[model samples]
Target: MPSISQLRKEEQALHALLFTQAQYKNYIPVKSDSLLQIAEAYYRTSSDSLHKAWTLFYLAQYYRDSDEKEKALSYFQQANIASRNIENNQFKFLLNLHWANLLSDEDAENKGIEKYQTANKYAILLKDTLKQIDLYGQWGWCCLLTGKYDCADSLFNMGLKLSTSSKMTYYNYLLNCLSLTARERKDYKRALELVNRSLSLAKDSTELYPLWNNKGEILLEMNQYDSAHFYLSKDTRDYDPYFKATHYLNWSIYEEKIKNLPKALEY
Candidate 1:
């Protein structure tokens, strides 16, 4: 059997093939299944084990997005265990950070934070500035989600400053983080500016989806429901849950207002 790296290469090639044929979109599940088969086969034969972990991680994402939470959690945990066996501190830290993020358990969240911090420290030691920026952004969002506003603010500011100073365009992820923080702080104007700038430069699907979602959320909060709905409807599967939930909430609010507005006149 081929190793995990070989299987991963095949998956990448498959992705390339799919991109060349818009028709492959119809058979996405078949492609996913094939990818998983290769992953499983790789797991059975690979000795280093990290490749198997990586395979599970990729499959877990596929399942998660497909609304299979249990399977995602299972694979994510498997990836964490595999990560522990590796000698590379940086990769291990990266795996822990991701594994922690995928977990819904509170204990897992704490563990994830611990791993994230460790990864950040190691990344600094390696002078892997890009990964450092990414880790800060990830940890910032984790803190924000967990209601640690001060920690979130500190991490976001640190990452944003480093990204800006380094002129690393890939680090535009920090802009999104900044926009999120600003919005949470009720600085809608600043949030809008940061989000719009990112949207203007967003070239790929990964970048565009978040930018649109963020813009939609801000617009919704500003009572711009129509624009929010339009953007939210663009891609249902890819946008952030926070953004999607807010979009739905705003839509409901607007609908209720429309229904109840005329009746209020009687009072």
Candidate 2:
């Protein structure tokens, strides 16, 4: 038999491969089914409780991403029970965070908030500074999306205070989120400034897309029609199939705003 560590490593690699497939393509149906079979093998063979928990979590996530929420929730609950048998706070925190995000998407906001609050407590208990910063980003966005601006501000600023000088991506994520919050509150001037700062810090196209789109939207809100078109046109690269649809939607809206019905129809 392989050493348990070696087995876990193999399982982790398999999970990463499956996760990447799911991210880009929604899923590879055949590959996903094979991975689940492999996960079941791990669950049956592992005597270690933590290893069992880890397999369960990955299976749950795959199911969730594949739109099998009921099955996902069942496995997640099993994972949670198994996780409690291990003494690792980091593991516990991650489980809580994933569960929280799922619940949030299911429209169970109160349950999601409770799970996030528990994850933050676990982060503090473990003294995991990076996890602390990440939770701030996660929870801040949660609050922002739910129309809780004051709560979002407090969480983002707290994360900023704890962030180290070397991590620009962390700061970039926070600024983009904060800019959106400002935009939702109709502080267009503040939103423009914050998003521009975010764009300046971006290290790649992934970071650039959201910020560029936000700037264009801000210009549209400000009645700067030509500037809006200019900035929005800059976001020409196809991000992915799903996001390409979003790009077309944005362009269509922009054309409507400019009263170009023919162009809107073309978009």
Candidate 3:
């Protein structure tokens, strides 16, 4: 059996998807700082082409997750170059996926969707279930962002159904996303129910924090001011870049609801 890196051109694309799957599972930036340093030194000295490309991509991802966007972008480009001789599209797809995410968050939704859809074709060719499901979930969020609520619902439900055998964490996330659709529909009661169900499924506080924030947002939409404040206040912990942005966004909205206009602006 061939390793992903040694697989044929099309199958080698699985390398990027596999790397992405393992990202959420083993990512620990602070703890791996020294390890990364050692890895970098080894990469600098190593003569193996395969190791060089792999290390480049890993460093790119590390820098990306650490919020060092310039370095991440540089390394991603370098990694692509390092692997240019390989008969595989994994490197290109990996770069495109990250670029798509950045584009989506920066308001270039159509460009982002194009990249994501292009990558989805590779995922489908590989029969990568998790990647397929993740695309649906992410694409659904993009739709949600564009106020296509019904389309978002269809995509998210398809993702949720596909992920039935996945981890509880993913299941809860889909539930949380579904509640977002409900919240957007102004079905506050349904939103509350969906979020509460996610809370019940959460294994720990790390999982609960986002749901608390979501619940708070739903309560605010329902005009339950005090209860909204209660849940929102529970999520005081600083989160990763994406979640931190969401935290501030909800906080801003909560402040706006309470008529604290100045404070809302501050967030």
lDDT of candidate model 2 versus the reference: 0.79
The Cα local distance difference test for each model comes to 0.67, 0.79, 0.74
* Residue-level lDDT tens digits of model 1 in 105-197: 344666667667767777877788788888788778888887676788799888878887888865567777778878888789999998887
What C-alpha lDDT does candidate 1 achieve relative to the native structure? 0.67
RMSD of each: 7.3, 4.6, 7.9
Q: Candidate 1, TM-score vs. the true structure?
A: 0.60
Clashing pairs in 1: none
| Best model per TM-score | 2
Alpha-carbon TM-score of each model against the true structure = 0.60, 0.83, 0.64
Which sections of candidate 1 miss by over 4 Å? 1-46, 50-53, 56-85, 104-107, 170-173, 187-248, 255-267
lDDT of 2 by residue, 185-222 (tens): 99998998999888988989877878888899889888
| Residue 240 lDDT, candidate 3, scale 0-100 | 65
Of models 2 and 3, which has the larger TM-score?
A: 2
Question: Of 1 and 2, which scores higher on TM-score?
Answer: 2
